[model samples]
Target: QEAKLWLPSAVPSVSRLTVCSVPVVETEIKLRQYRCFESLASLRHYLSLWTRIVLAQRAKPRSHHWSTRSQKAFSSVRERADDTAERYRRDRQAILELRGRGDWEQRLQVLRNEDVLSADPGLL
Candidate 1:
């Protein structure tokens, strides 16, 4: 049949043979190209949970005595969380700037050549 004859050509044999597993690093980097709504939604949900926790903890009566160490620990935790969120924001911005309608396949291939994904550390 005509379909049978064309099927062989349609699926390039070389591409099949060359379909080796991508390195773990390259795999993660390339996966970022695909939009993930579920992850974004989950992140938003977690952020909301953290906000609620902060509010609830604030409403709770503090022990009559507050230790300096406890205050320092709480402050450190909040600062670390803020820093993490800022890093994600910057990373997203850097990725957008690097993309600028560029070809993902080409960009991925180039990235694989070096351990570094982008000159900008944000992509890391």
Candidate 2:
């Protein structure tokens, strides 16, 4: 019998915003110059827009938008995101605290290895 890894689903919903029609290349200076916006709010807005564009690319990611390897990488990311969100409702604060420590990847690695710990572990 072939044992399948209990991995997260392959497909997760992605935001629809990509730069297929528009050329979206970045040079370091260009990015740094743009990052120098006078107001943080304006910079944040640009970042937000860029995020949407990237999300769109992920939603419909393909060789047209990115390479096959990149698309696979994005899918892994999207699956992890879904897993985190789905688990957060009950363990939100604990998750946030662990994330804040900058050891989030390490902690989540344990989750990837261990059994789930539902917090009403006491009565059981």
lDDT of 1 by residue, 42-113 (tens): 345544544544554567746645445445655655455454444444434433433334564343232122
Query: Cα miss at 33, model 1 (Å)?
Result: 5.8
lDDT of 2: 0.35
Whole-model Cα lDDT of every candidate shown, in order: 0.40, 0.35
CA lDDT of 87 in candidate 2?
Answer: 48
TM-score for every candidate vs. truth?
A: 0.35, 0.24
RMSD of candidate 1 to the true fold?
14.3
The residue pairs that clash in candidate 1, if any, are none
